[model samples]
Target: MIRRHMFMSALAATVALSGCGGGDKSTATPTPTATPTPTPTASPTYTAFPLAAAAEFNTYSAAISYTGDPATSAVTLGAASTETLSTRVRLATDTAVATGTYVMRENTEESRFCVPTGQTCTSTLVTPSAVGNPEFVFRTNDATTAGKFSQVEYLNNVVKDTSSNVPALVLNRVSYASWWRGDSTAGQKRLAYTAWGYSTVYTDMPATGTVNYSTLTVTGRLVSTVGTTTAINKVTGTVTMATNFATGVVDMTLTLSTIPTGGGAPVAYGTFTAQGAIPVGQNQWTGSFVTGSPLSGTLAGGFFGSQAEQVGTVFSATGTFGGAQQRLIGVVVGKK
Candidate 1:
């Protein structure tokens, strides 16, 4: 074998070399873990994650509540009172929320004082997206979400007057739960809770001590055809208004019908009676159901001196307001 040798350099380059007997290559350490490598094999990939993500596409509703210290002066006792807020929201997934409206009532507790005492409070919403002009709009705050908690925002549009002890109007975010039912689910609504996306709400109604708190209390009925493809919903609601401060009488009713797609098929209808003081510069109205038949007419001969306008299929309801009889008329033009 060739003689091994070591060598050293005197140059300032500091290069050094050694000559020695040839030795076997040093051993390498055995790695505790094998290097993971992505194999180029074929297997079925799951889409469940994306499928679950699609859950956000459905309709969502949430309840909300918040508190506000009414800005008041000594002259106004309830003016700077404590006001509470309640509201609901509906939205399509991933699309900035659609129209949000307050659920106004005829006898919300808060409205009584704001409208004047001894009156019932009422709630209303700008459905049909045609409230002409909305009374309030809220910009949700960065609210923490647990389970079923939606977003939060500050509602600035509704405010208690400087002369009243009322709460400010508040916009309500929604709390949402989801369920899935397809032809495959076998009529089962697979419900699931979402993390940090839900809330409860009460309309922040301003009212005095006398009538009900301001809130929407209407009944809704949804009738759907097989497969839930075609739905029919009818809504009837009422708002009771306070009579004069002396009379202390208030009554009003409202009926709302929505077909989801208007004229297509109604998914719900709401109707109720509300009682509260009329808004400033507004008239108080009431309603009642008088005796009337769908298919009944009297002979013209029995009319010694009577006049009745030909009633439509929708019928009519009459009530007395301020000791004066009042009448309200409605018609069914599209699909029920």
Candidate 2:
């Protein structure tokens, strides 16, 4: 059963976001038996996470919990003070997520009961819901160990690229939602994981409009494994998102000469920056490097926009490399 009670502003999310959320991962899967030991090689200087990649996932951390029954077990009256209660909790199974149109249902929870007096019973219950935020970051990979979880790449947002830098007006906004199965190892090991997120970006950037070979929208998420320093408790999947404009430019081709494994990989530290010229009040000028990924949806008062600029017109962007082995992909459209 789900119950909504008092709002606890003091309570943060429960899930843990490792590293900064973005991570570089090569196509090669690590051998599960041995610690990855790929040899490091030289790669491009600029970087980006492969499919929602980030270096912060390697270092970002968090903790969370709820004070309710996981529903997987029944609360048996203790004959003495030494009896134990056994149950499993599922986060999504205990949640009701919907608004007006779409109502998606994904269950999370399990229960069990025993009196220790030769009596046993079984029941089902939804796990209480909980979650936490994580630091959002992005990093890239090379031909070698691009996606292994080690000392990964991240954006040194604190440092500005000489080419262009400005105060964070809207700040970067990112969020996420995740579900867990009861049979998972983490739960079996008395562990629980909750996934949640948010971001602080500069002032929101106005649409520079749409261009050929480009996309525009503003929604992103942070995803990574959660566990202790010794072992991985929960292996997180990809945090998919759609962005027509994620600030700056993405490289078109990234080739890796060498690959590294086991030890930490190299990193590229810089900025993912971009700015567009949109006509505000006709002939007037106002612009901002995009603070969020711009996506295209239905038409509203101001949903779709279009704009273009000549190539090699001195439209410059900058980024950084965490190590020697980082690759970046950028795309530029419009005639030169």
Best by TM-score: 1
| TM-score (C-alpha) between model 1 and the true structure | 0.20
Against the true structure, what is each candidate's TM-score? Answer: 0.20, 0.17
**Relative to the true structure, how large is the alpha-carbon lDDT of every model?**
0.22, 0.20
What's the lDDT of the predicted structure labeled candidate 1? Answer: 0.22
Candidate 2, 12-112: lDDT as tens digits? 22212223333435356767887788987543222211212221210011112211122333211111000011112111111111100111122232221
Candidate 1: segments with Cα more than 4 A from true spot: 1-185, 190-221, 225-254, 260-270, 273-336
TM-score, predicted candidate 2 vs. hidden true structure: 0.17
Error of 2 at 96 (Å): 23
